[model samples]
Target: MKLQDSVIAITGGGQGLGRAMAEYLAARGARLALIDLVPEKLEAAAEACKAAGGDARAYTCNVAREADVEATFASIIEDFGQLNGVINNAGILRDGLMIKARDGEISKRMTLAEWQAVIDVNMTGVFLCGREAATKMIENGDKGVIINISSISRAGNMGQSNYSAAKAGVAALVPVWAKELSRYGIRAMGIAPGFIETEMTASMKPEALEKMSAGIPLKRMGKPEEIASAAAFIIENDYMSGRMIEVDGALRL
Candidate 1:
């Protein structure tokens, strides 16, 4: 539970919330094995973690591909000796209306590519990493934690049919996995974050961002460190499992 000298593998640890989480845990003396598609970003993150006084390494991986994930985990285990926890934080957004007409009129009908792409990374990627992490934890007979990064959109967002469905499915699996893995001393949990001030949202129009902020009770976007703090809390609180914490500033979205 304590991050000090524990091994943790974080997917998409290059930027945004994942990067922040990596830094926070690393500062607590957690050894890190970070995976990301962008080598440049990963380099920056790795440097930051090392500067924070932790052992850290980076690997390029595509979580959507099981082969890639398996190989990357193998490399990580080889390098770190063993892992105490894993953070399934890798995700991508392909936001669009399920259906868009030639005139750009959006509808409820989603395209196969739109659905599959999001599902491939957001859903399937989580599944692959969680499975691999659980297997390792169980096989090693070591108590560990598995944290799945979910989203506020899981409850349902108008243009996020694919993202919403995938996230919802992920949240639904938390309890099931926790019950199944509890015997092995492996805890499962989910974190649903609201509008966070990450690179992904930096492109939003100021007016749109303001409108979104107004919808939240706190009236502003959250910081990546806020979510990272929640991650640290969950990992340290041994009894907190099979549940989700929403770090969305009281925003329903």
Candidate 2:
């Protein structure tokens, strides 16, 4: 679809990859409904979008909650008059080894709560928002695109049983949703990012960052804008659906 005049809703648009995408899409002339947990951050992003010459608004939402997602969409429809697309970009990280033992005795294992928390936001949150957006698209009878933000961790990473499982589910959901939604003229896709230099990675120790980058064949971490660029491409290109575009710089990790 054309970026100009398109109504695009983004979850977690306050910061990180979400914020970057909001800025990019806004610059391209899309009207935005940016949803995030932090109202202040959303406000800040809204200001930036305005500065970039785009029509934009912000909504504070906990994407993992059904009430919040539904309410946010209601507000979006009220404000934008129509909803054409969505980016399920809200996610969280809670990493831990599933099993840790010394001398064969189990010393540590991932807690169910830890596992559930990540899954709730990363996996289930995607489902809720994607479903809501698809329904709206169908109801409006508008051709739409839904982009789910998956991660390279979906390939199975150490010390991230919860995150890995959740991400893997996200990747799987892309194809399933594509099949189901195709009949309605809606498309679903996923982006599995690898080693992006965002706030989370910046917090890691310098040596640790070096060690991680060493694994990437390009010897570098990806930028949020890189992922945003990929997203823009997917949304504009109608033939691309049920696919997971890896944004990693040849990084196995």
The models' CA-based lDDT, in order, is 0.89, 0.90
Residue 22 in candidate 2, Cα distance off native in Å:
0.6
Which candidate ranks first by lDDT, i.e. highest? 2
Report how far residue 25 has shifted in candidate 2, in Å.
0.8
Candidate 1: regions farther than 4 A off: 101-109
Q: What is candidate 2's lDDT per residue for 166-232, written digit by digit as tens?
A: 9999899999999999999889999999989788889999999999899899999999889989989
Angstrom error at residue 44, model 1? 1.4
Question: Per-residue lDDT tens digits of candidate 1, residues 122-146?
Answer: 9899999999888877776668898
Total clashes, candidate 1? Answer: 0
What is the lDDT, from 0 to 100, of the residue 54 in candidate 2? 84
Once fitted onto the true fold, the runs of candidate 2 whose alpha carbons sit more than 4 angstroms away are: none
